[model samples]
Target: MNGIIGKKVGMTSIFDDAGRNVACTVVEAGPCVVTQVKTDDTDQYNSLQLAYGDKKEKSSTKQLVGHFSAAGTGPKSDVVEFRDMNLTKALGETVTVDEVFTEGDKIAAVGTSKGKGFQGVVKRHNFRGVNDATHGQHNRQRAPGSIGAASYPARVFKGMRMAGRDGGGRVTVKNLRVLKVFPERNLILVKGAIPGPKGGTVILHK
Candidate 1:
């Protein structure tokens, strides 16, 4: 099908049988429980809600506890719904890493990028500032040069690139190769990096 909920378990480099080193990101994939199944007739769409990682009963909210109860599972620390899944023969059943993917499979990862807060035009938008650094340039060295023509429109256009927040948004990287799949440990090693920090949650799709 399309998806799996996984945890980023840091990165490592391993040598292949050919004695070539490969860089990979190890991820703890599944052993994920099917918490809820949404069907077209019943829920107006088709999807499966998978839950991973456990939490104390006391730490779970009533709604989450009830959701888990419906699935005959314990409270999970994370639950993500995957839509339009197929090639997954089991629903309301535990899905292990082996069932979803294998080595050398091509997949995509979606994650939130790391945040870079309150940056200037130079850093944020890559604007080239005043070139005359020696001729009394003063503070215009880092300033946004010309916002607009002097009097034509007389206003800065909307959607002009300016200093602001960067990152911390949904980013998808496509065509990443699966370097390894360890079903026993519920781990999958992708050939390259995914987004976000070390422990961020990422959704992998075929």
Candidate 2:
């Protein structure tokens, strides 16, 4: 369950050894600092608290400043805990992208999907409203018709699909193949698209 915090660096295509075009999402992972090492005796559980990216000193809280300072590092923009990390590392240690993952490894990326604010059922829930334009149906093509029954259940069902806010939620994309690893650049190329828009933060779990 080793993992690291990263930023989605957009997508690109590369040719494999077989000359097959492979679509991959580029991620700038790590050089994460181990801010804290929690043990069962001290914290009632075992986990590694890692911090990555950079933040302005003025923008960071006093508590956060003290926390990273304890690790001999500056303010970090993202922090995450990995409970199942097998390797033992001391606080203030650095973890890189290539140190945990390699080419051909299968990984899972967790991120927030792009927000589609106030969407309709047609796009949100994939509702095919009023297939036919006839029967005097004018602008009801994308409408969610008849939310509830008239007599039996006077109100709409609790889980009924309707138009509302969409996306901008935590999403996990599993089994993404690790196409390549650039240790020097701290970049990892993973096959297939990952959640979130460009520059969004993502956690790569191996």
Candidate 3:
């Protein structure tokens, strides 16, 4: 597995070789430092721990500061691990977007989706909430009508879809094509939308 920590820079459109307009998400990927390298003999598994994005010294804990120092790097805001990487790298070495991915490569992006805060069933679960406004129905159009049966259940069952919080959860979008890679600026253009709000952290894996 090859992966790196990155930030979502937002979305844009580009023209492909055939002049077809393709919607793509711009990501500021990598220039990540290898903080740790786990081997099967030492860690019982093979994985590469990477760190990216600078963090203020006051905002980071002392332990984290020491950890980054041990790796010969400064404090980082994001840290992630990738297992089964093809190439071998030593600690403190940097990994860039162009090193792992290229144009037309299929990859997966993992990140937190945007928070919608408190939401109704109609918007949260796509419930058609009392479709008909007839039979003296007024403000109950967006209501979640009935939650449970009267006699048998007697209470709302677990895993029931109702009005509540929405979004702001880990989401993985797979099979996204790498539209372009700008190693000079450490940017990656992935075709299609990815999870998380603008400037939010994301992990791109292949």
Pick by lDDT: which candidate is best? Answer: 3
Worst 10 residues of 3 by lDDT: 129-138
TM-score of each: 0.85, 0.94, 0.96
Q: What tens-digit string does per-residue lDDT give for candidate 2 at 92-193?
A: 999998878989999999999999999999999999889889889999999888888888878878999998999999999999999999989999999999
Q: Which candidate model has the greater lDDT, 2 or 3?
A: 3
The positional error of residue 137 in candidate 2, measured at the CA in angstroms, is 2.5
- The local distance difference test score of each candidate is 0.86, 0.94, 0.95
Ranking by lDDT: 3, 2, 1
Could you tell me the lDDT of residue 49 within candidate 3? 96
lDDT-wise, the better of 1 and 3 is 3
Is 1 or 2 the stronger prediction by TM-score? 2
Q: Over the full model, what C-alpha lDDT does candidate 1 score relative to the true structure? A: 0.86
- Tens digits of per-residue lDDT for model 1 on 1-206? 56788888889999988999989998888788998888889999888889888889999999989889878888998888888887454445897878888888999998889999988999888888998888988889888777777788889999988888988999999999898898888999998899988888888889
RMSD of each: 2.5, 1.5, 1.2
Q: What is the Cα-based lDDT of residue 36 in candidate 2?
A: 98
Model 1 ranges with Cα > 4 A deviation: 55-60, 87-92, 135-138, 149-154
What RMSD does model 2 have? 1.5
Candidate 3's C-alpha lDDT? 0.95
